[model samples]
Each structure stands twice: as structure tokens, then as C-alpha cells.
Target: MVTAARLGPEERARAWQDLGARELDVLVVGGGVTGAGVALDAATRGLRVAMVEQRDLASGTSSRSSKLFHGGLRYLEQMNFVLVREALKERELMLTRLAPHLVKPVKFLYPLKHRIWERPYVTAGLTLYDRMGGARSVPGHRQLTRTMARRIVPALKKDALTGALLYYDAQADDARHTMMVARTAASYGAAVLTSAKVEELLRAGERVVGARVTDVETGESHEVSARVVINCTGVWTDDVQEMAGGRGRFRVRASKGVHIVVPRDRINAEAGMILRTEKSVLFVIPWGTHWIIGTTDTDWDLDKAHPAASREDIDYILDHVNEVLSTPLTHDDIEGVYAGLRPLLAGESEASSQLSREHAVARPQPGLISIAGGKYTTYRVMAADAVDAAKEDLGPGVVDSVTENVPLVGAEGYQALANQVERLAREHGVPAWRVQHLLDRYGSLLTEVLHVAEGDSSLLQPVPGAEEYLRAELVYAVSHEGALHLDDLLARRTRISIESPDRGIVAARDTAELVAPVLGWDADRISDEVAAYEARVAAERESQSEGDDLTANAERLAAPDIRARAVGRALD
Candidate 1:
């Protein structure tokens, strides 16, 4: 059996010591999905690998997403056939081989506006969509009349569509999925550490060697050596390149996208809905107990880390979706609002929408590889190519990439375990629905979460403010998922920060306590962390209630980042 991996203080020390003792074959500079995938790909290929992130895993764009894994239907309009097929193939890989624990199939309805000439045109496209790389891991697409479409989506106005086409695509909790990818890499002998910032590149006469890494938690800096360094920082790709003192092949620009989550009752949709908008595609995705409606695409010049969504943006979505709805959803119906930036390849065109989603990997120098421009679905292929680029640096007889056949940690017996969920739930004394939820989220590794609840029934109770899930999840986030702060737990680990009306405020104290034992934080520390999370929630709330962008941004900026505070204190 493969040894279970954990990144403790002792292991962290060993990781650094190995850097000086021997040069690492591959060093990844991001903790997002792409970086995690790179680490796993390199490690599986029998090469020494290490990954460092400046913040918590997936703290940036990776965490905030529309959370769908689809063959880019809009790409068909542009005739970007190759990109769509490539992404579909990778999506199939994720649903089947790579991260079955994290990714699953979701069905969406495409409503048609035209009465004539639309069905055949849309049907042909969907038929091609079903055949083109998507059929490998998902069910076939179905054609439905307007009545049938309305039956599944009652909130949609009857006259809004002439007919519909339903198709399946993959969806995931993006943040958890990214962390699992990182953890899976660690399980396969890759050294993964979060909150380790790369201050500068360690270079020897113009060739990249390694990095100077700082432990944000301890304020300790260490010199580490590597043979090949791959920059996997998404929106911050340019920053990493500058640190390595190399000119990148391409520049990255930030495009802000926003999503709003409301209770499922508000939408009354049996399946998700996808519609064409004047600017971009609008989706009402079906999340568990909630509906996720999103996404406005506009260039962002403000904060890249936490892109604030203006009240105007909210009204934009509300107005558009309300136009197609029988009963409109007002501000009161919104439970959560989040905005994330897409790391798009920059272009001279005025529209960010015209920019390409295709990722590019280039080795500007002999020992440095920088990968940018790819979408989430193609991360594994990107990682594989990245490792392949370091073949010379890893020395003679470097093994070929074997990640295509390697299953992610929770994937081995997932289907079988899913079939036995009812029996497992009966044995565990929990409801079948709860068991299904666990199996879906954890796959075959649901036992890891259940172990905590078995000893103490109290841990099984739903959290106070959220009440959507278990308290054991909070404990697991710290013990296994690398949750560093209260915000990490509430925002990314469980998404209670965005799912609830109060944004996990009432549950903050309990979540802090749950992580205290695992993190070894003192009482004062826990209180401070909880307070900080509450302030963040408050800031976001205030931001949404404002009338315009300027006031909203000011309100959102009022919240303090825990790492920024530590940085400020260190400077003082």
C-alpha cells in the first residue's frame, strides 16, 4: 500500500534539507489545480518533485469558479473545435481516472428561443457535442419540447423557450478538488506545502536553479535548490516569471466573473439551465440544496486577489435572468455572492471575451518552464507536458509521464462504494442521503470522515449557522485538507461563507474551536481568527448592499487578510 502523506513541520524541514543535499528535478510554484497536477505528474514519472504556494491552496481564482466541467459550447460558435475536443477529453479523464472523488456529472438544459430552424441546428450541435469527447464519461444528450423543458424548470417563463436540449457535463467543488489534487500528489511522494512564498529565484549564471522560500506561518526563510522550476501561478504568472528574472512568452490579464447562490426553492429547477447572453453565456447551475446563477465577464483592473463584484454587476445578472423567469429573484433571495478572476491570455482586442482560453507552456530558459492560458479541464495534459519539458534537467533515463493511468487517491473503488452507500449508511447509523453526500464528496475515502463521527456522535451534528453538513468536516479540513485559518475553513473547505445568509458568522466560533486541536492554536488566537472571518463576512455583506462599484469596493476592502496583517507586523 502507498504510504499516506502528511505535511507536518518535520516533513517541511526534510523537504528543505533535500533541496541542499540534492537538486530537485521539478519545483512547482503554485498550489492551484494546475500546479497540483504538475506535482503529481512529475512525481508519478519517477522524478523528485516539490510544490510551494504563497498562500493557502487555491486561495485565488482556483477557489472561486462557476464550477462546471463542460465542453465549451460557446467555442463551437467560434469554430474552436480543437480546444473544445481537448478540454472534453481532459474532462472525461477527470471524471473517470484522475479525480473521481472531486468531479461528477451535471445535466444542463439549453433553452432555444427560435421556433423554427432552431431544433435541427441545436440538435445537430448537441449531437456532435455528445459524440465529441464527451460520450466517454457521461450520458447521451436528449431533446425535449418546450413543455418537457418547463416541466423540469418551472420557474422559467413558459414562453421563454420554443424547445430545449439537455446534456451532461462535470461539476466540482473547485477549492476542495484543487486541494485534493495537491494532497494526492503528496501521497505519491511529491512534497507539497502551502503558505510558503517564493521570494526570489535561485539562479546560477542565467540558468534557473531553485527558489528562496519563506514559511509565512513562522516567518522563516530557507534556500532551496532545484534543477527545473515550473511557474504554475495562474493570474500571478507574470509575477513568478519576474522573480525568476526571465521574460515570459506571453502576458496574462485578469477577467472578473461573478456568481450568486440562492436556495434551490427559489429557482424550482430539476436540472440546471444554460442560456445565451449578449456578452457571454449565462448559467443557472444546480448545486446541492442551492442554485448557482452566474457569471459576468468584464476586465478587472482592481484587486486581482479578491475581485469585488459591484451592485451594478448584481443588477445585471438579476435583470437578465429575471427576463426569463416566471417569478423574479430579488436581492432578498441571494444567499451568497462571489467574484473570481480568470487568468486570460492578454490580447490587443478591446473585448476580453475574444481572448483565448488555450494554455501555453514555454521554457524561456534552459531550466525554467512557464505554463499559462489553459482552462481547468486540461490541467492534467498541461502538467504532463510541463514534466516532459524538464526531461533534460531531470538527468538521463527520466521515466515517461504515467499520470494518465494513475487514479487520484479516492478513485480506485469509487463506483463500487457508491453502489454500497445504502448499506454503508445503515451500518454507520446515518441517513442514506448523508451517506450519498459523503460518498459523492469523498468517493471511496468516506471512511476518513466517518472515523471521527464514530467515536463522538456530537461531531455529526450540522454546524450552527450553516446546518447543511457535519462538524466533522470542519475538523477534517485542518487535519487533512491544510486549512490554515478560519477563512480557509468557512470559505473554501465547506463554502459555508458563501452558502449561508449570515455567511457562517454564527458557526465561526465553533469552526475555530474544531480546528484548534489540529492547528494547535491558543484561545486568543482562535478568538482573533474567528473575529477576522466575521469581519470579512461583514465586509462582503456591506459591499453587496451598496448602490455602486466604488462604495462596494471600499466596503469589501475594509476586511483584513490574515496573512497581510502578519506581513504588516513583520515590517513594523
Candidate 2:
């Protein structure tokens, strides 16, 4: 059996040592889906690979997406068949083969305001969407009358829709999926390290060779050499290009997208809804116990690391979503809000919504490759194309990408384990629902998580403040998953940060205490972590209240990064 690639503190130290001791075939910078995907692709192709991220995996745009894997029905209307077909094929692959444990089918209802011509138009596009990639994993489009549509979605206003068309797409927890990709790469012998920032690019004369990486935790620096350096920094693509001492062949524009989460009861819907906005489409996705809405597309020039959602952005979404809801949502109904920046390829269009979702790869100079602008669904393709671009420096022995055949860490035996959910629950002395939840999130790897609870049934109990999670899961996050801080566990490893109404403030102290022993956090460090998490939540709340981007950005920046604070104390 292949050993599960556990990324605890010990493994991270080994990775940093490996990076400094040996020359690598590929060094992938940026730990988002694309960068993680690149590391997996290069590793599976029999190349020595290492990946570095300044923050946790999927901490940026990867975690804050609308979380859909679709053919972009709007693109079909634009007559972009190639992009739609490619995305749909990738979607099918994910649902059926690649990560069935993480990605699953989701249905969306498109409410039509017009009586006659609208239904046919949407139906045609959906029909094309259904057949584009030979989509067979999920059911095709279905037309519904106003009564039938209302039966499915009770929240819709009586006259809000003349009729409706329902279509199938897939959704996944983006951060979890990205972390699994990184873990899978590590399992395949790739040195994956987080909180390791690349301060500068290493060059041998005109050819880029490697990078100088800094360990954010200890403030230690190391020079790591690689034959090929692939840059997958999404919004910071141009900045990395500048670090290479040359003008990039293409420019990357930052587009801000914001999503608000509300309790599931706030919107009485059996199926998710898709509404047409003047600039772009809006999705009311059905998340577990909550409904995710909004995603305003606007230009963002301030902070790429932590994009702030203004009050205007919130109002824009609420007003549009209220157009069809019988019971309208108010500001008080909102549980959480998050903002992310999409690295869109620059074009002539003034509106960010008009920019292309297609990705571009450039060999800006020898041994340097940069990829940008693709959406979440097509990250694997983008990664493969990036490696293809780096083939010149990788030499002739490098094999073609086999990531399509590679399942992520927990995907294997998932179906069998899912079938025995009841038996598993009985063994663990927990509810079947809890077992099912663990199965969905960790798949066959649930055994490893449950192992942390051995000799103590208390670990099986639900976590305080966030009862949806098990206490064992928190310990496993530090002992197995690469979680170094409270924010890493709350935000990306699990999703308590964005899911909780208090924005994980209520869970901070308890969660910090839970992982303190494993992460070697003393009393002072635990207090500091809890304090920092509280300040972050407060800053986010303050930012959300601001009316404009400038004020919001200023407010959000008030919270200092934990790593920066550590560096500061070291300097003192």
C-alpha cells in the first residue's frame, strides 16, 4: 500500500531540509490549486519537485471561489464552445474519477422572467452544455413550469419567474481540495512546504535557476536550486515577473469577488438558484446548513492577500437576490462574508466581468514559466500546460502528465467506506451523520483521523462553538495536516472561520488550546494566537461595515499577520 503522505511538523522540517540539500527538476511557487496541481503534475511525470507558499495552501483565491465546476453557461451564450467543452470535460473527470470524495453533482435552477422566448434560449444552451463534454455522470437539463419551479424553490416570488430551466453542475470545498492536492504531491515525493516565502528569484546570468526561500516560522533563509522555476502566483503574477527582472509578456488584472453566507432556513429552496445580473451571473449555492450567495465582480487594486468587501458590495448582492425571494434576506441574516481576488488576464474590456476565463502560459525567459488567468475548474489543464512550457529546461526525459489517472490522497476506497457508514458509526459510538460527515471530508482517510481518538472517546465529541467538527479532527489537523496556526486550522484546514457567525472568534480559544500541545504552543503563544484570531475577526467585521474599498482595506489591514509579528519580536 502507498503510504499516506502526512504533513505534520516533522515532515515540514524534513521538506525544508530536502529543499536545501538537493537540486530539483522543478520548483513551483504559489500554493493555490494551480501551483499545487503543478507540483503534482511534475512529480507524477518522474521529475524531482518542490513547492513553496508564503501562506497556507489555498489561503487566497482558491478558498474564496463560488465553488462550482461547470461549463460556464454564460460562455456558451458568448459562443465560446472550446472553453465550455474543456471545462465540462474536466468537471466530469472530477465527479466520476479524480476526486469523487470531494466533488459531487449539484443542481441549479435558472428562473426566466420572460414567458416565451427565454425558455427555449436557455434550454438550447443547457442542452449544448449537457452534450459538450459527453456529460453522462449527471442528469441533463429539465424544463419546469412556474408551479413546478415554485414547488422546488418555495422562496421564489409568485411572479418572479415565468418558467425555469434546471441544469447540473458540480461543487467542492475548494480549500480542502487544494490541500489534498498538495498532500497528494507530497505522497508522490514532492517537497511541499507552507509559510516558506520565496524572497527572490535565483538566476545564472540570463537564465533563471532557483530561489531564495525564507521560513516564515523561524525567520531562517535558504537558497534552493532548481532546473525549472514555474510561477503560479495568481494575482501576484506580474510582481513575480518583476522579481525575474523582466517585463512579462502579459499583464494580470485583479478582480474582486465577494460571497455572503446565510443560514439554510433563510432561503427555503430544494435546489440552488442562478440569477442574471447586469454585469455577470449570481449563484445562490446550497452549502451544507447554509446558502452561499453573491460574488460581485469589480476591479480591486488594494490588497491581493486579503480583499475587503465593502458595504456597497453587500447591498448590491442583497438587492439582486431579493428580486426573486418571497421572504427577503436582511443584513442581520448574514452569517459571514469573504472577499477574494481573481487574477484575470488583462484585455481591452473596461469591466472586470468582461475579461476572459481562459489561462495563458508564457516562457518569459529561459528556465522561467508563468501561468495565470484560469478558473478553478480548469486548474489541472493549466498546470499541465505549465509543465509543457517548462519542457525545454526539464530536458527530454520528462514524461507526459499522468495526474488524470492519479486520485488524491483520500479518494481511494471512498465508495466502499461510504457504504459502511452505519458500521463505522457503531464502531466509533457516534451518530451515523457524524460518520458520514467524516467520510465526505476525509474519505478513506477517516481511519487516520479516527486513530487520533484511540484510547479516549472524548475526542469523538463535537468541538465547542463549532459542533459540526469533531475534536479528533482538530488534533489531526496539527499532527497530520500542515496546520501551524489557529487561522490555518480555522480558515483552510476546516472552514469554521467563514462558516461560523462569529467568524471563528468563539472557537478561537478552545481550538487554540486543543492544538497547543501538538504545535508546541506555550501559554503565551496560545494567548497570542487566540488574541490575533479575535483581532482578525473584529477587523473583518469592521471592514464589512465600511462603505467604500479604501476604508474597508484600511480597517482590514489593522490585524497584523502572525508570522510578521513573530519576525518583529525576533528583530527586537
1-572 per-residue lDDT for model 2 (tens digits): 35669999999988988888999999999999999999999999989999999988998999999989888988887787998998998998888788899998999999999987988888888888888863589888898999999999999999999989888899999999999999999899999999999999999998999999999888888999999999999999999999999878899999999999999999999999999999889999999999999789999999889899999999999999999999999999998999999999998488898888999999999989999998999999999999999999988877888988888888899999989999999988999999988888888999999999999888999888889999999999988889889999999888898788888888889899989989888898899999998888989999999999999999999998876776664455
lDDT of 1 by residue, 27-84 (tens): 8999988999999999888778889988888888888888877788888777888888
What global local distance difference test value does model 2 have?
Answer: 0.91
Count of clashes in candidate 1: 3
Best by TM-score: 2
lDDT of 1: 0.84
Positional deviation of residue 370's Cα in model 2 after best superposition, in angstroms:
0.2
When summed lDDT is taken over every stretch of 10 residues in candidate 2, the lowest stretch is 563-572
Off by over 4 Å in 2: 569-572
